[model samples]
Target: MQKSILWVFIALLAVSCNQTTKKEGLTTEADKTEKIVTATINELLASPADYQDKEVAISGMVSHVCRHGGQKCFLVAEDGETQIRIVPGGEIDEFKVEMEGSTIAFKGIFRVLNAEQTEEHVEDHESKEHHDVEQSHSTAEKAEYFVEAIEFKDITP
Candidate 1:
């Protein structure tokens, strides 16, 4: 009976040690260890190729979130000429519409759209009106690079 009690105590202690404590903000040990390169949304878009396939960090105000489920988010800077799509992964589950206008810092790897994705993006744009069609064509020309986020934390004031 004493041995059973001792074993239960050991098991409880092991579980507690493995558990992760949630802090007010989402800052993991991995985030701290990564080479987080802080840049604005515009900077990233301006030199997408330079940051391609490399881990980068960017901070921007969220302009939109996927209405259906918040699986994706659009980040924009002051210039607003370009935007970066944030594909939430790892610790990030979804982005809420309420998060709009809130500043967020994201750490992730940048990737460029493949030929198939570019074709599909253009096709989607072609479905809209003539003006939107032209804009979509331009978006297609831009290569549609995006970031695959591993971590994101709100920095709204």
Candidate 2:
């Protein structure tokens, strides 16, 4: 009877240790996948290539949200003049018009268009009748760099 009780205790200890190790492994994996770099809009625009295809966290004041189906939005940098475009991705269907004029923080991947893609984007922008007059965000709207946002939060006060 005594030996049986000792063996049972040993088995329980081993099982508990194994469960703890598994939980630790899961936490480690989550840490690796959640790694993200934070940056400002101006910094991102200045060296877009450095952050290309990398997950980044950025915050800015939402300057505009496309009136057409909210397919896209623009964020003004701390400089107050420079802007960068953000498109929904990773389960996000679209941006909301109410986001305009609010400060928002976004996490996503930075993408840059190739030469041909940039030219096409520019042409498309120029074709828009509403763009007949220049605007502060016009440069960013027609530029090759933009962010594909996976998550966002309104931090406006």
Candidate 3:
């Protein structure tokens, strides 16, 4: 009877340990699946290479939105001078003019145009008649770095 009881106790202990290990494994898997990267606009701009093509979350104040067809928008960093361009993607159709001056949080892929692409973009911008005058966001408008936003939310206070 004593030997039998000892065997039962050992089996129960093994089962409990196995269950704990499984739970821990599940937690680890959950962590791995929830890998959302939230970053500041400045940080993303500082190292565009690090974030290229990667999905990231960033927030900033909307400094400008293209009035032509609302195809694009610019977000100013905390420094107020620095800005980055954001183009709609995913299910988004356009950025409304009302969004300007509102703080918005955006989730998207950080994209960097290659040298050839950048040259083409600059040429295209210069060709536009409306671009003759340099605006505050002119630099960012022609920057190689921009975000292709998939989702965004206004967080203005």
TM-scores, one per candidate? 0.66, 0.77, 0.77
Look at candidate 1 and tell me the lDDT of residue 48: 73
Clashes within 3 Å, all models in order: 0, 0, 0
On residues 1-157, what C-alpha lDDT tens digit does candidate 3 reach at each position? 9999999999999999999999778867755764457988899888889989988899999999999899899999988899999999976899999999999999888999999999999898788755667889999999999999878999999
Write one digit per residue (lDDT tens) for candidate 2, span 1-157.
Answer: 9999999999999999999999778867755878678999989888888999999999999999988788889999998988999999975899999999999999998999999999998888777764557877778888899999988999998
lDDT for model 2 comes to 0.89
lDDT of 3 at 67: 91
lDDT of each: 0.72, 0.89, 0.90
Q: After superposition, how far is residue 139 of candidate 2 from its true place, in Å?
A: 0.9
Candidate 2's C-alpha runs over 4 A off are 1-32
Error of 1 at 61 (Å): 1.2
Candidate 2's TM-score reads 0.77
Q: How high is the lDDT of residue 146 in model 3?
A: 95
- Candidate 1 displacement at residue 70 in angstroms: 0.7
